[model samples]
Target: MSERANAMRASILRSHGGPEVLRLSELPAPVPTSGETLIRVGAAGVEPGLDVRTRLNGAGWQLRFPHVLGASMAGTVISSPDAAAPDPGTRVAVAPNISCGECAYCRSGRDNSCAQREFLGIHHAGGYAEFCSVPTRNLIPIADSTSFAVAASTAVSFGTAWHLLVTRARVSPADVVFVVGAAGSVGTAAAQIAALFGARVVLGSRTPQNLRELSDEVRALGVVDTTTDFAPQLESIAPGGVDVVVETVGSDTWAGSVDSLAPEGRLVCCGGASGGEVGLTLRDLYRRNLSLLFSTSSTFEDLRLVLRLVDEGRLRPRVDKVFDLADAAAAHAAVEAGGLQGKVVIVPESAA
Candidate 1:
């Protein structure tokens, strides 16, 4: 390898176990292949359980080992193999969810359902490095006014929240929405998106401090009511029940999410970061005429909409802190410790 290529650093998971397995190592910088671009990674977002799963190999997906694990990232383009690719030095957010373009789901614009969809840090190498390669089509230009941390943090949290609220549940102006786990990344995003739609948002979390902080942040965006007591609070405010429940915490919050909804209400779930399964009765679901929607990662279009919202100042991510690339192990540990109100971002020294 050339001298210049030998200096790149990355966090690699050679074996599954705990946060200690993530090692900072000097590796050759990635070279952009045809229709791909090499990014000088400025920032990458961390989702606690997801990172832990990748580290522990518990995500129920295949891995090649020695994997780079970052799902959402933002950076400047340093190299591109296609004329249509963003020029070098252009700031961009990398959308990690790469769906097969030839699939029917992709053709219908619901690419999140594409059978052959691949995710960075999971299906392939990802951005826990100084440099990483991504498809040319996945780059979303970042505005000069926005920071890379914000750009990196938005796609998974805000995009998934946007899909759950606007695309799936069809949250509208007249609705009353309850966001379970309203203090976490996806929870905060859900609260903001629901409020942005003019819905009366009820933000709920087990932690009082987290609830207060998140509620304060979203209040400037739109109307919001917060609670630690999920069911009782919803009943007190809406009486009949809420129009939609954004449940991402799973298990612990699942039953309450179902019970808190009104007749024909929608419960949109995209994750279970809490790590457990919950069961529901068929009779109860049918009787309530409730709709249960299971959403996965965001679509390419969803990411674009979120970026547009960020650009318009209608939406913004709550970034807790930025860790240096070498401190990736510490970043994972902090996320696993919990009580974070926003994303833990990792930045390369070159960008810093």
Candidate 2:
């Protein structure tokens, strides 16, 4: 192969700040090391919360310049030296979370909490390129029928939602669940998962039009316009209060989320897109008997389960838009603009 053929096109962040920082350039394609598989990236999901934050401020995580910033991706395997790894040409979804298997959290199936966990895009070169080198263990084979865009979009949002609703909150059929920021990818996944579990799901969004449309699309039990005071609106939906609150929008909706919960209610938070810090009242927590929980990324099991669901047609992963590799900067700008109903995907030019 010629020198240029050996190189790949990638959107790299040389410095941090606005969407303009991401530039398309030729970088040497990654070579798979022992136990790692090189993949030709087909699609990479753009997470508004994570990607946007990482682009704007590095998300408080230490970074090396010329970083690639896609957290979740799906692609076709090229080659792997490890015999146990999937064969070349296999379609797969790359799991973003990498945890040491010997850790107690991994042994207990709670790998998302592993102390030595690392993330793609943040800690390593990611899929915002024509190729990526991923650990063989992170490669989960996807069905031939699953589109790269859909598979790339599933792991982060759906797995996180599953972890929050199924594992953290333990939502039940009798539970009344309210999902804040229902228009975003994670929020939409959370609402759908809660509903599938037979919970009465309510949707909330600051964009009234988007909220109303999403409620109708998801067939949520009710809707709450987050532009104004939503506590009273939620009160009418569930009478006293909801049994579970899926809080992804942080400070902006934190107080209201706590206030909208019923006695013995559970509030599971997975993101802080709006802001992180929030004040709490000791009296309110003790008086209502509320359970506050926080979840990070999802475990391997969560990723597997969600992927199986999507493959089986039980869960539908939405792709809001697709941009070629060169347009990654615009993709980030779109995500930051908000009001998107589904995930925005970045497709490498070669794949497109």
Top candidate when judged by TM-score against the true structure: 2
The parts of candidate 2 lying over 4 Å away from their true place are: 1-5
Q: Tens digits of per-residue lDDT for model 2 on 1-352?
A: 2244589999999998999999999888887899799998999999765677888987778889979988899999888889999988999999999899888889999999999998888899998999999989999999988999999999899999999999999989999999998888888899889878988889988875776656766678788888788988888888979999999989999999999989999999997878989999999998989899999879999999899889888888888889999999999999888768788999987786
- Model 1 TM-score, all chains together: 0.94
Which 10 successive residues of model 1 have the least lDDT summed?
A: 220-229
lDDT of each residue in 215-242, candidate 1, tens digit only? 6765622222333436665666678888
Score residue 210 of candidate 1 by CA lDDT. Answer: 59
lDDT of each: 0.83, 0.89
lDDT of 2 at 120: 89
Residue 251 local lDDT, model 2: 96
Q: Candidate 2 — which pairs collide?
A: none
